[model samples]
Target chain A: MEFILQNLNAQTGSFLAILGAAFGFFLAAMGSSKGVGLAGEAAAGVVSEDPGKFVPCMVLQAMPSTQAIYGFIITIMILGKINANLSLEHGFILLFAALPIGFVGFLSAIYQGRVAAAGINMVAKRPEEMVKGIILASMVEVFAIFALLISILLINNVG
Target chain B: MSKKNETNFLYAVAKIKAIENRLLDKSKIERMLDAYTPEDALKVITEADYGYSVSEVSDAHIYEVLLEEEMQKTIKLLSDISPQKEIFDIFMQKNDYHNVKVLLKAEFLGIEKDENLVETGAIELRKMKMSVKERSFIDFPPILRQAINDSLDTFGRTNDPQSIDLILDQACYKQMLESAKSLNNDFVTGLVKALIDTVNIKMFMRLRALKKNWDFAQRVLLKGGSIDTDVYINNLESPVDSVIELLRYTSYGNVCESGIEDFKNTGSVAALEKLCDNYIMGYVKKAKYLSMGMAPLIAYYVAKETEIKNVRIVMTGKINKLPNEQIKERLRDLYV
Candidate 1:
């Protein structure tokens, strides 16, 4: 454990900053992929029977993808904070900032995908009721949005 | 029951949801019941997308062929989508048992293949026939092979065909319970238990009506139902009213009570049979809200079967010129 800690300490601040940005982007993207994939499967079934429903089905499938974009923005912000004089403490703070969105976005996106997949059923049965289904699925995104907001706030406050 | 298997049903469940809208509602059934003639009834059915031609509808055999074809198509669709085919195989197992009864009876009567044999069983009708003819069950599952042997032995000893049905019915429920348990699904298990209870109740009522002895009732009653065997045995000597009172605390008490009343008024057991089917449909109707899982799939299959049964009842009633009210009384509840 001491050896690992000493090695981590020996690494440059840019390396740690890069690691934080990678975590934020990769974890959120993975979560979004899972969520969208599940919703896409359901949408394909609906569209197979009725091709006209492709638009609404696609909308539901795309709802979980926002987390990935949020993750990408956090990644860009973390990269911007990396400098030649970047200290270990500031790099660690950025890493901690990335953790909130990375973990929360990952979990919430998957659950939201489940909700969106269920919503696809609603759209399949009642096309006019697609708005209601979208609203219900969007309810799961509140936590992911909060995490993104906190991530941005934390990265912005990093000196 | 891995996570992958659970998630694999999303597409199938979505497709089922869309298809569920096409199921016959009460209003359509009422329209069919209101039709004045068989041809008019056929028109109602054909217009509802049952895919039967006028001539096919006119011929009773052809109509049955169409219904069986539709049932096969539905089963095939489910089997194609399901990660675990055994869940649907449980439903097909009933048809296998039905074929067993037919084959055993045919063999005992020294007859050729019976045309009444349904071909939708998990085991093909031809293979089952071959197994019965050769007196070997090499290709059959253990539970089914044992059932065939036991039924044939009982028939051989007593030379009574009725024992075949009794023995096979018990074996069928036992196998269904085993299948449900293997899937580790609570909903399917509960549905099978309800089915066993209904079968037991139907048998009890029939035996009671016949003034049969306790030993005979004991022989016909099935185990693995929610009701205790002793309850049925003790109630054998009692009147139907006492039996109803005893069942009042059970899950199916109300259905049993209404069935008894209908039996009294009509002097026919058909009303009770309809109630039993409706009870099962009512139980599975709860799965409609489930977004993903085997429950909705199982429920959809049951609903489709119920729809076919109702269509058959209506078509037969129309051909026989039975009264509308009588036909209406016999129709089980529609899933929609």
Candidate 2:
């Protein structure tokens, strides 16, 4: 235990923690960027047809990326536990766990972004009936939220 | 790949094509027209494949079911293509208006609260009821409240029925323009601008029929549309004898020329409004085809909504046992 502690000191472990968080943030942000960008394209197209529909569509598009922010929080948690007796391998394993959340969350969010954007277009055309579009777009975010929750839970448990 | 897996557009188009087969055709409309009572109409509608049980349905139910299915297909086609939530929100913005109106009307008229309004727009029924009960639009989001407030004076000041409607129309147009400008998308901005232009033309004719002050008419005319407002205004007050009046020439001259003629013949603004809706629907269909990607989707949505409006008109007409000719006249021509 002492040997392990000395080897995994403040320097190496702190660097690993920073690296882990950075990677997690990178993965999550990349997903959000793609998702938001794709959604924006669809929203713009719908707005072109009917400008009144921008708000709800934008809210739906932005909801999925909330996971990426959750991923950031997890990374911050990992960094705080830098010298708190975290095995480098355990820390690394936890870091990888964080990656899937960001990767899957980002991909899922992108698809949802598209759905939400299209949903916006639907709203633009049928202002009389927009609940259906909002519901359909929201359904896409369920899986992404689940993915994010699991990653955050895992990170919390690790600390 | 069989026709199903060929291309997303082909697939969507094919699916829509197949679904169109299930829609109520002309013959069905004829049959519906012949139905004497609401029960008979309901039975005829049930036979149509709109993906819902039409039997035991109310006038609003048929509208809701058809709107839902079309919305589903729209979302299906659009889900993987692009993110257009903001655009969708713009369409839903009217729901907020609808909801607000229902609330206000119910409170003012002492009408029973029906859940029907919930199926209409984005606002939750509970919240909508609360806002209505509160007699204040403040509980809504700032944008919603602003939109509601913007139209209040129009709703309040108009004593004439047609003039009362003009307030809502003007408010809708103004909100749409403001919303479009806020988005910063040239395509959307252009489409919205054109829509406003067409709508303004229609409004101009209506005001003229009412013999309104030209300055008041000018106040309602939104600037930055595709057509020049000054030219349109000059033409609005022009005599019928000078048909070749260069100032009066517009892309909308064809459909609206008839309305202008009708305006002279009967002086009814309703006909002009109907012509405007029909012309705008035609322009939207043309624009959708001209622009690809989400433009088609937007077009499809607009087409579907117009179709729903048409359907509603037919259903309402049928329920009231009105003549088919009158219903047909009220229907907006769609790309279907």
Candidate 3:
């Protein structure tokens, strides 16, 4: 009975760590997909009218993709710590570590997408204002970066 | 596929924003007005998107043809690009109603006035003509068909052509209001109401100038305006000063003050018409700030119409060899 309980704990601990990585990756990736999709729609509208504006629109549409990268970095760091002997306590800590990035990255990407889309429309009307739009879109990335920092710090303390 | 963004007009609005730069403005019109010859004035418009190839330009006298083609092109562009096309019905239906009026009048009077029919209505001119000729109302909107029947019955009894204008004009507003309400959009609804008020004001002043009876004016007045119908009715017998006083506090105060003064002084609705156009332009200028939805498209349409009207005014003055100041005085405000 003792050996079986120990085996179950080992399996659950590994499962929990992998689940945290999955949450961090998929949630943020889904947000990026949403963000890119929204900005892409507005970008296509601009490009259709004036193909010369394709470069600026392309830059604006790419702004939301960084959140996914942040989530991915945390996800990889969590996975690097995985092993057969990982305790349930460490599993819970890893899971908690993933939560901030998962939630923040997901929301920030979607909201950033909305801003980028609006910016793309602005750039269409006044092509010279493309820099202003890019700067506005990057503001949403700050919170996402902070979440990534805390997530990495938590993963480092898992030992 | 994922549900599309809530801003369904994103594509159309963005394209229109780019296209709007090509619209004629004050300086463009000034160039046309200041040009030495009629053809030179024509040259000014040719540079804009009047939907005419340079080879198609035959003569300045036929600038009307160019204007007509541009109107058709504008209608096609809006209908083709807009996702919420039904919202435009409120505007395009005016042409449909105009076509019906022309066909009905021609049938009644046995006159050949084909030039009165335009090709730019929401419904095709041919369709409206056939429906009017055959007495079929199936293809028409509910209020419009009923207006036709009512106008026909009233004409049969009274043998008056003016009744047709009254019934059709009122029905036009009713149909416009219906379409506006169905959209549930505040901007469009407010625009339609403003239009009704302006039309009512114009009709009241004209009927007053003609010395028409109060009862006739009341009957002809449209139902859906911000101002009450009785305001016109009660003031029908009063002098123009009291009417001006009554409307002084309304949003149309400037229009009434200037339009009524011009009407009283010159006995021409020309100034009044110009002021009303500018007032509507003022109303639509609000759409310039909006980056989404159908506001910009509608604003562009109004802007183009005003541009076309000014072009016609300039061309007429140029051909007649009138002074530039006179042409400038007659010109409506520019949208850009």
Task: Give the residue spans of candidate 1 off by over 4 A.
Answer: A1-11, B1-4, B51-61, B264-266
Instruction: Tell me the tens digit of each residue's lDDT in model 3 across B1-336.
Output: 112424676667777777777788778888998899999999988878575555588699988988998988888888788887887888888888888888988999999789989998878887787788889989788888899999999999999998998899888888988998887777788889999998889989988988889888888888888998899988888988999999999999999999999999999998998898999999999987665677778888989899899999999999999999999998998888
Using lDDT as the measure, name the better of candidate 1 and candidate 2: 1
DockQ scores for all predicted structures: 0.70, 0.02, 0.54
Clash count, one per candidate: 0, 24, 0
Model 2: how many Å of interface RMSD? 9.6
- Candidate 2 has a TM-score of 0.53
lDDT tens readout by residue for model 2, A6-55: 77563565566677678777776776776676556556555544456667
Docking class of 3: medium
**Stretches of candidate 2 exceeding 4 Å from the true structure:** A1-159, B1-44, B51-53, B58-82, B105-118, B132-143, B147-171, B181-191, B222-224, B228-236, B240-248, B287-292
Q: What are the lDDT scores of the predictions, listed in order? A: 0.85, 0.60, 0.87
Output the better candidate (1/3) by DockQ. 1
Candidate 1 per-residue lDDT, tens place, A47-82, comes to 877788999999999999999999999999999998
Report the C-alpha lDDT of model 1 over B1-336, residue by residue, as the tens digit: 555666788888888887788888888888878888766766666676664344556654356766777788789888887767889878899999999888888878888667778878999877877887788888787888898899888988999999998889889988998988898888899999999899888888788778899888877898898898789888887877888888988989888899988776776788788889999999999988777778889999999999989988998998899999888877888888
Candidates, ranked, lDDT: 3, 1, 2
Q: What does the i-RMS of model 3 come to?
A: 1.7
- The residue-level lDDT of candidate 2 at B276 comes to 72
TM-score of every prediction relative to native: 0.94, 0.53, 0.90
